[model samples]
Target: MTISAAFSNALSGLTASGRASGVISDNIANALTPGYAKRSLELTSNATAGQGVRVLGVVRRTDPVLTDNRRSAEAMSLNADNLARFHADFGALIGPSDNPGSLTNRVAELEASLITAASNPSAPSRLDATVNAASDLAQSIRSAGTGLRDLRTRADRTIGQQIDNLNGTLQDIEALNARIRRVQLSGADTASLLDQRQQLVDQVNTIIPVKIAARDHSGIALYSEGGAILLDGSAATLSFTTAASAEPHMTQANGLLSGLEINGMAIRTEGGASPIRGGTLAANFQIRDELAVEAQQNLDALARDLIDRFADPAVDPTLAAADPGLFTDAGAAFLPADEVGLSNRLELNAAVDPSQGGNSWRLRDGLNAAGPGAQGDAALLKAMSAALTDPRALASGNLGTGVMTAGGAATAMLSITSQASAETEQRASFAAATFTEFQRIEQEIGVDTDAELQSLMQIEQAYAANARVLEVVGTLMDTLLRI
Candidate 1:
């Protein structure tokens, strides 16, 4: 071969080695970055084309099938985790009165006072203690209601932040798509641009799964799982907005980024879906709606049950027709607004006042056939205690059948909370196992140290051989000139 030809071939070999080295450097740099796919230089022999060689592009190492499966499993695991947290928080609110100023303990204290009062029908000191117990129970209910409302408010704020993040990520993805298309059209090296774009796509996946499509110029287009196009070409972009109805919406239009839009879709809904998933957005939405709101409703229901049952003469004969309930419904019908539930109509009746009605007024369970006026006060108290312990009585619509005495709401809350705690722990364990398995499978298909090292050795030897050829060519050229 001519000296020039030999020199050129050697130069090409050096270039190929450099490219391989760059790929190896990149793989090592991002070894720890989550969702980072490895890449390799795609080289083609130039001997066939009557040229030195050509670098096709930097191709990312990935398995689309494995990625999709991992994402799906993550969604289910996250759902379980969120449900468990909801129950845990609710459980905290539902347990015994001894929990550092918990309402359940306060209610129990009041019940003890009432029992004491019953023992000495005419003792003024006993009556006063009974009144104090009732007042304390009312305070406990108010605090619990406030705590639940606070949780709801925090959830709302988190939802707003997640929506903002989703918008930002979509904009970035659209912009990257435009850059990639432009590079491809200009016949420039678009390998790095593609890498950046893929990284963006991976980020979007964490927020929600996306469907990617091929573009005409070897470019890519992204779409939501729902078939709404997120990107088209250089002329089209998807935009998202919070509509007047405050619902999340997405739309596609003109310009690199003007078309695609997403409006008010929370991380998840009742039927289990949202435009976004996988990452923190899904977690936040679950807390806001399902966990926080549902717990609030459960507490509200319990409160209403307490108030309506205690205010009736059948449950507390000392409570006259005009008197308000013992614990007072401090909550509005759908009220998280005021952060408290109370009955405006609850008050002990003065006519058959426990202090003055010959100390004859009694507390009765709903099952007693005798009217409040006829049942002995002692029989009513026993029935109320029995009702508080029975879940069936609580589930039944008959508040009179089981007057949830002081501490009853606390007991019910504890039960709900315990169930939730178990669920949360179980879900977390499952998620951990799933994540570990996914990583194990991915490592098998991912970068292999032994393979890359062996390839590196071969590339280096080829580079050295090519350098020797260049050196010989230079020596020959000098000798011929001397001759």
Candidate 2:
């Protein structure tokens, strides 16, 4: 080749080697960066005559199929994790079956107190103890109800926060899309912009399950798994009105609770059956609307059973047909429609409450008797004890349609809690295993430091050889000019 042509080839070789080395260095530097794909320099022969090489563009190493799979797995893992956390919290609130503070233990204590009072109906101390136990039982139900509502409120607040974060992320993605398009049009390197976009996509995936679609000018559009468009040319809006507090009666059916909105349209917030499924937000919705509500209903049912036990006309003949029982609903008779908040409203009958100007001897008499009857009359105390042990059908769908004693009802509630906790834990384990496998696959496709070093060595050699050629060419030109 002529001297000038040789110079041109060597110069091109040096440029290509420099670019390759730079790309290799970038790959090594970002080896541990999350969502960073390794970069490689793409080179091609120049079609023009006598041109040695050309750098076409920068290529990012990635497995789109694996990336999509990982995103899906990550969403599932987060969903299951949220569910497991809420169920575990519920289990803690109810406590273990053997725990002294548990519902069963409280009821058992009340039953034992009744038996003692019945055996010695004239003893004021035993009567006082029996009344105290009954009061404690009512307080326990109220505490459980309050806890369930508080959990629901917490879930509602978290859902609102998640929606806000999701909206912000969508806007960021939209901005990146515009930036990517502009860079592509300017024929500049868009690799960095692509990496930033990938990171944002990963962030959004944890909030809601989405399907990505490539658009024109290197842009992307996102759609929910339920086919709702989350983003297109612009970011879609998400809205949620958070409640300051939650109550058992503040249900969606009564319009006292808030639901999700997507671009001014209502969407389901139920559970797996909801429009947006398989993410942390959906899981929170399920906890707030389904799990917590069911727990409250079961508690209210137990409260209803307790009230019914003391309100039976045969047990207390002085009580009118509509009179409040030994255990009353806010000191009044329980109406079926008021069952929603019965646990929270349950109270000991004022006639038997010492703090309410009532006497302990009244337990042996009647709730509305003219005065304390014969103190040795143990019939009323014995009947109350027997009522607690008698089997009756519960008023809660959570326990299924079945007959059970007060103690049995407590057992059923605990069984429901244990089963739910176990199922959630199992799902979380499976999702964790699946996510780990996907992450491993992604790591395999990530930067290989050894391979990058090897490539760097090759680039160094090429650079050195090109520098030698250029030097030789300059030397030959100097010699020719002297001659």
lDDT of each: 0.56, 0.88
Each candidate's root-mean-square deviation in Å? 8.1, 2.2
Give lDDT: candidate 2, residue 110.
94
Cα lDDT tens digits for candidate 2, 119-218: 9999999999998999888988888887888899999999999999999999999999999999899999988889999999898889888899989998
The lDDT leader among the candidates is 2
Error of 2 at 296 (Å): 2.0
Model 2 off-target regions past 4 Å?
271-273, 355-357
Q: In TM-score terms, which candidate is top?
A: 2
What is the Cα-based TM-score of model 2? 0.93
TM per candidate comes to: 0.72, 0.93
* lDDT, candidate 2, at 171: 100
